[model samples]
Target: MTSRFERGVTYAILALFTVTSLTPVLGILSTAFGRQSSLDTGFSLPDGLNWGNFADAWSRAHFGTYLMNSVLVTAAVVTATCVLAVLAAYAFAVMRFPGSTVLFYLFLAGLTLPQEALIVPLYFDLRHWGLTDTYWALILPQTAQSLAFAVFWMRAYFRGSPRAVIEAARIDGASSWTTLWRILVPMGRPAISTMVVIVFMWTWNEFLLALVMVSDEAHRTVPLGLAFFQGQHSSDTVLLAAASVLIALPVVIVYVLLQRRFIEGMLSGATKE
Candidate 1:
């Protein structure tokens, strides 16, 4: 009875925190649909909801093009990060090789390195290859930046996996790649889901890299595009708010769909502790 009361109290506290955190987001959401007159209005649902604001923002900002570019770049980044990290992590966790620990630590080292430190070198490196202002510039750098986190996540999941299962696969003459593809990755769905959510969030919110790497307006990502929109529509608060809602929609949708997996992955990771 006492334990149940404690659990209920903890849940109440958490609920309060969740609502507090969501207050700002809710405010933006409210403003996005509200009338221009409502900006000065008190905090409540708009007296008149304006659906035209979204349509106007979309048509005026060339958001369709921006959305396409973001989709392409984000898809490439997510796919590359997942595949490379899973392979590298399986190698480190399951394979017996020389300097394995050293190599893993090297990958771990990347997690601590700031993007600002590498931006200058990356700029020159991309420019030398004549890749600047291209999708490759954005896709390549973001993929690389996200790889360290993916590898670390997959490695931890793999480390916690059962040794007997891997040994049995090896006993059956499964090659390293075969074991990773057939056994490990299939079982690492929780980790993969977590990685997907994290990578998507990072890629979606990435502004500095997109702003720096993508010079052409056509190639601008959503965040960078938002900045562009703000510049172009500085006085049009209604349009800006509507664009903000559209920009934030994809992430919300993805989260809604995969939230179960994400929560399971996160909780399971903590479960091991």
Candidate 2:
């Protein structure tokens, strides 16, 4: 039913988008496996593939340690953010309190506040608390930073939930905590999953806080490690690309796994009708 012109335009747009999205990824992959002599040239498919780059990157960067640290930090952050966000969101959404709206707005203000703006104060605060150079420094502050957005997101989802179910649960003698854990949480899984993915991505990619907080080599996250790799040697392009791919692997995997739930949550949140 489509006209030729319309079909051509559609194809053009599709190709543009495909190229835009895949260009960097493909470039990275190609460089990761391509020969070292081609470093200065713009990305293209290599004539011969080299698997040695991955092995060299793995050993040179101590990416195994970095990966472990990243996983640990990410896991801790997601778990803490979910628990705190869910509880705070449930309170804000379901409970009645004086100045609750004002307080919630105060939390919402955190979304507008840039991390760069708070870096100086946060540095001193962490040092004062003797949390610097430790996992707690990174974990605690990151949790605090992520809480505002998490609460806002979760509260929106909770607010959109059916009130009748909550009322019925209350009438059935379900306690507040019981209702939240048993009823609201189960229903809000999609939203929670979306938040989890987003938070994981942000935390995984976070660099500044990780740089400021952890002085030790062993505690450096993937981003910091990648930055180090990029700066280590100008000629090490293949290894650099391999490291980049490894850095992005977890995010790609997680997104592929939960993309359905993420889309459902986003649609549910954005559409009122």
Candidate 3:
């Protein structure tokens, strides 16, 4: 029982927020193609699109190397996070053991600890172990952070899974791992895919971890690489815009491809069959 006025107000609010979000994106798009002589912050209707900015930015910023590094780190982190989260979440959601609840909550606590609070201590610890300035530095910390949230998110879905189905799998002579892989995993594809996409985006966009951990130019992630590029190319607005887009494109492409699965996963958790 909704009234027209309330519905209209809701639509109006949504539209307002949508435009607010798109405004900055459009501004970046405009600035990416804008001439070097221009100084405006927003998009100009009259300014022609300049495609060369992307090529210029790529060559100038050494984005190819940085992009590859980001891909490697993101892939490793996402893979590790997904694997670890699935196993950890499954145990928390289905298995009963002494101290399991306490251990699970400990993992959840990681979600509350901001990177800023942890980065300084993390740096010294990694340095003591000689892990800093290496790809392992970037991959390991990001995976741990992503795992904390991934386990929390995925445990909800796994907990909602049918106990009857789990019992059936066990009765059929399936071991715990077999039941997980053959039954639970297949049933949880939507949730797993969603986890993968989200972890990929977070790991790719991660900056502070990369910045403090990786002092070497060769080990830098895309966000850290983009920061350095922005530092030197601060005067070239168009190039900076182009670099931003380049750094962001892979994530955009991934989301676009998996958007359908993501939506289904979100809705899956809401509706039980």
Model 1 lDDT tens row, 49-137: 78987998899888899999888988999999999998898888877799999988888898999999999889999999999999999
Clashing pairs in 1: none
Q: Tens digit of lDDT per residue, candidate 3, span 195-256?
A: 88889999999988888888888888879988999899788787888899999899899999
Give the higher-TM-score candidate: 2 or 3: 3
Q: How should the candidates be ordered by TM-score, best one leading?
A: 3, 1, 2
Give one digit per residue, the lDDT tens place, for model 2 in 1-273.
Answer: 999999999999999999999988888888888877665434877768788878888888989999999999999999999999999988999999899999899989989999999988998998998888888878888888899999999999888888888899999999999999998898887899899999999999999999888888989988998888788855677778888888999999999999998888888882122
Off by over 4 Å in 2: 1-12, 270-273
Model 2 local distance difference test score: 0.88
Please tell me which model should have the higher lDDT, number 1 or number 2: 2
Q: Kindly report which residue pairs in candidate 3 clash with one another.
A: none
Give the C-alpha miss distance for residue 266 in model 2, angstroms. 1.3
